[model samples]
Target: MATIFQKCKAKGDPCRRSRCGHSWTVRYREPGGRSGSQREKNFPTKREAQDYGIKAENDKREGKYLDPSAGKILVRDYAREWLSRRSIKETTRKNYKNFFENHLIPRLGSKMLCNVMSSDIEKMCQGMCEAGLSRRTVYQSNMVPLRSLFRSAVAEKRISESPVALASLPRLKTKRVDDKSLPGGEAVGAIASAMRGDLAVSVWLMAGCGLRIGEVLALRDTDIVEGAMRLRRQFVRVKRDGVWKAELSPLKAREEGEWRDVPVPSLVEHALRHHLRNHGVGADGYILHAHHGGHVLDSNYRTEFRSAVIKAGFAGESWTAHTLRHFFASSAIAGGLSLLEVSRWLGHATIQITADIYGHLTPDAGARMRSVMDGVLATTNVSRDDS
Candidate 1:
C-alpha cells in the first residue's frame, strides 16, 4: 500500500520550506518486494501524490505494477546488456555494435529508457535524413536496431512501452527489377571475358547460378553433388581478437547444417572445370582463393570486378557484382520459372520478397486468362449446338 506525506528535512516535522522542499511524497513498497523495502516519489501536490498512490495500488491488484525506478537505466548501459544477451550471428552483432556506436548512442545514449519519447525517436530519424542518409538506410538499417531495443525493453518490463512503436519512419522507395536495371547476357559475357583467367569463373557462378559474392567465394570442389552445387556456407568477414578476417560462416538465414542445392548450368560447370584445371583448388578444396591460397576477401574480388567492369565498357554504369545475381533472377523470371522457385534459388527469406522485386516481369496474366476464357466459350457453344 502507498501513503502520501509532506516531505520535510526534520523527522515528523510539518511541511515547510526546507532543504528537501515542501512537496508531497508517495512512499510505498514495490508490489513484489520484501517487507521494509520502500520506494518513494515526489509530486508537487498532495492530490497528485494521492492519485499516484491509488494508481499504484490499482496496478498492483491487477498484476500490472511496474517499478518506476527500473526505467532509470541509461540507454547506453541497457544496450550493452541487451547486445550481450542476444543470440545473433557474429557479423550481425558487429553491425549492431557499429550502428549503436555511430548512430544510436550519439543521439539517445544519455537519455533514460523511460524518458525517451516517440518525438525523440522521430527527431533522431529526421536528423538521419537531414544528414543525407538514404530512405532505406534511415528506415531499415537505422531504425530496425533502435526499434528492436525499445521493444525488448518493453518486454523485459524495463519501460512501460516502446517509444518507437509510434515513431515516424522514412518511406522505403522500392525500385522494380527489369531488363533495363539488370544487365543483359552479352553484358555479363563481356564482363566475364574482361576478367582474369583465374577469377573469370566467379562471374558465371553469380550470373548463371544466382550466387552471392560471399557464396561464390565459399564454393568448394567437394561441394559439387550430383550435378548440382550444394551451398553449405559463405565466406564472411568477422572480427576476431580485434582484427577482421575472412572466415567461412554458415549460410545467411539458415541453420548450421542446412544447405541448398542450386543446379549448375553447363556454362557455370564448364567455367568451374576450366578454373580448376588451371588455378587448381586452394586449401580445403575451395575453388576460389586469395593470392596466399586462403579464402578470398571482399576487397580482393571487388577490385578485380571493378577493373573487369571498366574494361567491359561499363565503368560509368551502375552495374555491380551483385548485379549478376539480379541478372540471374531476371533470367529465371523470363524463363517461365515460378516466383517460389526463383526465391529459393536466390536464397531470399520468402517468395514475397522475390515477387516484390520481380513480380512485374511475370507473363501477361490478363492475356492468358482471356485465352483460357475464349477456349471455354468456344467449347460451350459447340456443346449447345449439339444439344
Candidate 2:
C-alpha cells in the first residue's frame, strides 16, 4: 500500500511551523525489499502523487516493479559493470568491448537507463547507418550488445522492460549476388601467387582445407597427423591490461580439449611442407609467425591479404579472407560430399547451418538421386516369368 502526505517541517522556526510547500510525497513499501522497508518519491501535485502510488502498487502486484532510484545510473556505468560480469568467450568479449566503447556508449552513455526508450535505440541504429555502417553490421553486431544489455538490465530489475524488444529494427538485406559466388581455382592461384612466398600457404590452407583464418594462424606441425590436421585452438586478439595482444584460445563452438580432425588434402599438405622448408616455425611452433617473434597478428595478416588481393587484380571485389572458406565449401559440395560431411569438415555447429549457406551448390542433387535410382531399378530385373 502507498500513502501520500504533506511533510510537517515545523522543527526549524516558528514561521516555518505553518508554512509548507505544495509538494506531496508518496511513501510506499518497496517490492522485494527486506524487512518491509519503505521508499518514497516526491510529486508536484497531490493527483500526480496519488497516480504514482496506485501505479507502483499495481506494478508490484504484477511483478513489474522497477526501483526508480536504481534506474538513475548512466548507461556507461551499467554497461561497464555488465561487460565485466559477462561469461562469454575472450574473443567475443573483446569484440563486445569494442562495440560498447566505440559505438553504444558513445551514443547512449550519458542517458539514464530508465529514461531510455525504444526511439532511442532506433535512433542509434539510424545514426550508425548514417555514419557508413552497413545494414548487417548495424542490425547484427551493434544491436546484439544493446539488446543483451537492456535485457540484462530488465532481468536485474534496473528497468521495467527492454527497449530493444519494442524498437522497430529493419530486417537485414539479403546477401549480395557477388557474395554467392566463390572464387575459382584460377583466382585462388592468382591471389596466392601474388602473396609473399612465406604467406602464400595460408591461401591454400583456407581454400583447400576449409580452415578459418584464426585456425590457419594457429596451426602447428605437431597437430598434423598422417592424413589430417587436428583443430584445437585459434589465435585471436584479446585486450589485457589495456594492451591488445594475440593469444591462443579454444576452438569456437567447442568445449576445452575438444578437437576436430580435418583431412589435409594433398594441395594443403604440399603447401604446408613448402612453407615449413622455407620459413620454419615460430617459438610457439605456429606455422604462421612474425618475422621477429610470436604468432602473426590478425591485422597484419589481413593487411597482407588485402595487398595480395590488389596485386592479383582482385581489387574492388568482395573477396575477404573468409571467402576462401566459402570456396572450400562449394568445392566440397561439388565433389559429392554430403552436407553432414562438409558440415563436420568445416567445423560448423550444425549441419543445417552448412546447408543453409551452401545448399544452392548442390543443385544437381535431385538429378544424381534419380540416376542412382535408375541404376538400382535396372539391376532388379523385374520379368513377368519371375513374378
User: Of the candidates shown, which would achieve the greatest TM-score relative to the real structure?
Assistant: 1
The alpha-carbon deviation from the true structure for residue 328 of candidate 2, after best TM-score superposition, in angstroms, is: 0.9
Off by over 4 Å in 2: 1-28, 31-34, 39-65, 87-103, 174-181, 189-195, 237-245, 250-261, 273-280, 290-294, 299-320, 334-359, 364-387
Query: Considering only N, C-alpha and C atoms within 3 Å, which residue pairs clash in candidate 1?
Result: none
Expressed as tens digits, the lDDT of each residue in 1-387 for candidate 1 is: 798887565367555555455788898887665763688899988889999999988887887777777899998999988999888778888889987887788999999988999999898888888888876887877666787899998887878778888776556745677677677889899999999878899999999999999999989999986679999899898778887788878887787878888998988888888999999988877888876788788777888999999999988888889999989988888788889888898888778778888888877678889998998887564445555
Summing lDDT over every window of 10 consecutive residues in candidate 2, give the lowest-scoring window: 10-19
Q: Mind giving the per-residue lDDT tens digits that candidate 2 earns over 133-182?
A: 98889997777778899999998899888999999999764452233466
Q: Local error of candidate 1 at 206, Å?
A: 0.6
Model 1: residues with Cα > 4 Å off, grouped in runs: 1-64, 238-244, 370-387
